[model samples]
Target: MTAAKTETFTSLAASVLDIEARSVSDLKRYLDANFTRACECLLACKGRVIVLGMGKSGHIGGKIAATLASTGTPAFFVHPGEASHGDLGMITSDDVVLAISNSGETGEVLSIAPLIKRRGAHLISMTGNPQSTLAELADVHICIAVEQEACPLGLAPTSSTTATLAMGDALAVALLHARGFTADDFAMSHPGGSLGRRLLLHIHDVMHKGERMPLVNADASLSDALLEMSRKGLGMTGIVDAQQRLVGVFTDGDLRRILDQRIDVHQAQIDRVMTRNPITISADVLAAEGLKLMEDRKINGLFAVDDAQKPVGALNMHDLLKAGVM
Candidate 1:
């Protein structure tokens, strides 16, 4: 594109970002008694937080529901239009209804507001107009008002939607903290994701064990350790003592350095050439912790040890990579 066109596009994007950011910042002023009451309503809710909205509001409500559900609160989105059909049965009196409407006059959302109330559910409204009918009927109203839309025509739901989403995030995070939600708790809700893998997967779950483990006696010749490393294909071998306790570790890096010193691989003792007092991890520790230890110590392999310092398992960086722990 031409320089003038490029400049115009960049300026427009920057303006949109600035407007949306300011709208989110302005939402802080609206976090009054109503926001606190809304939080209490949700926290005390024995049932799910039924989020209701239409169109653009519905999209944001769905994300808000997901965030609330994953963080600590139990929540789900019920389309207002569908609620009028048969989905209204999903809501219970013990639940809290979080209704979203940028104009606070959305026909679909307003149509079901009375039914939600009749069910004895607590109604929390999020809107730009606190005086709007839906807001007026709500037990608590959170104002997500924006000065103007990012749209040049000021008709689209740009800045308003951004503000609404930020407010929803604030509510979820506050609830998360109140409930003492932890990373492990979050990981349980996201077991299929990388974060879950990092938090939930243990060293024994990914490390080489049984015949897959490369190990040799500390008094064994370097050639014997090399044979074990070669057979296991881990580029390393754990050198153990008479009681099968880990004494040292021999790796490809050691081989390179030893070769430069003209050490006889066949005649040299494994313990003499191996790295003594190598870093180790327990089998119960998280694989992510193992990765951290490896990175911090500048090593590629780790031996999983038991209380007696016996090598129970072994793994290299490639093992972690294959296990998706990297």
Candidate 2:
């Protein structure tokens, strides 16, 4: 009986997923002139895009607003019920209103449709019914109709919500492209996010600078370089000439190689055994770029230098990990 129950559960789960997948995929057919018009409306919006919805659609609207805001479209979600209160004052003539309702008749959303138009704000509605009152009243109607709800009872909003969210993503991404939004622009909005760390965090930010960088004169003995490496706990050290300009790099990997060759760490000068013209990056280069340089060269550490090739900083794989740039 347990085995039978497992199969039944698996089959039901598969059916639900199938319904939701089709609900999203079928939206492509509905992305016609209305979708392009909606994009135009948002692209031309000078002030901000204000989103409205109620109930489950309200949750989806909030996510859409966040996505749009982060992706370069200045937007915020306003609960339709709140709009009827003093919140209506927030909308201006230059703004664009994006109303989401699976039923096309969420009373709270519909209640403010007329005022939204009266304020000279462009009204765009997303609804499951093309003939819904909200749809007729909108300057642009985006149909979010689905073949059926994933819910077996055909009552709860399941597949329809998924389709609505997907459509919202499509609209947001479309506008993001239209605006020529860049990774740097996105990072500016999400400074705390991982992508922001990748795009905004520079080598200098993650590198050990000044006294913290493990560095030694080129004439220093391998033992002296090793001591510096150990002191800094960076697994590597920079070898600099009398000019204090970077000449080479010595790493833990080189130390292992020297051990195999039986090179005397106490007797050998760093210049003779170190890796000359090692991979280097500029202080302003993105830490993500530094990571790629290390990964592509199959190395674990690097030095950040100025235009004059003087070592200004040093870092390794572990530093990148800690900086959240990985």
Reference-based lDDT, each prediction: 0.93, 0.94
Best candidate according to TM-score: 1
TM-score for candidate 2, residues paired by index: 0.95
| Model 2 Cα lDDT, one tens digit per residue, 217-240 | 988999999999999999999999
**TM-score, structure 1 vs. true:** 0.98
Which pairs clash in model 1? none
* Backbone clashes in model 2, listed as residue pairs: none
Instruction: Encode model 1's per-residue lDDT on 97-150: one tens digit a residue.
Output: 999999999999899899899999999999999999999989999999899999
**What are the runs in model 2 whose C-alpha is more than 4 Å off?**
none
lDDT of 2 at 93: 99
TM-score of each: 0.98, 0.95
Q: What is the model-wide C-alpha lDDT for candidate 2? A: 0.94
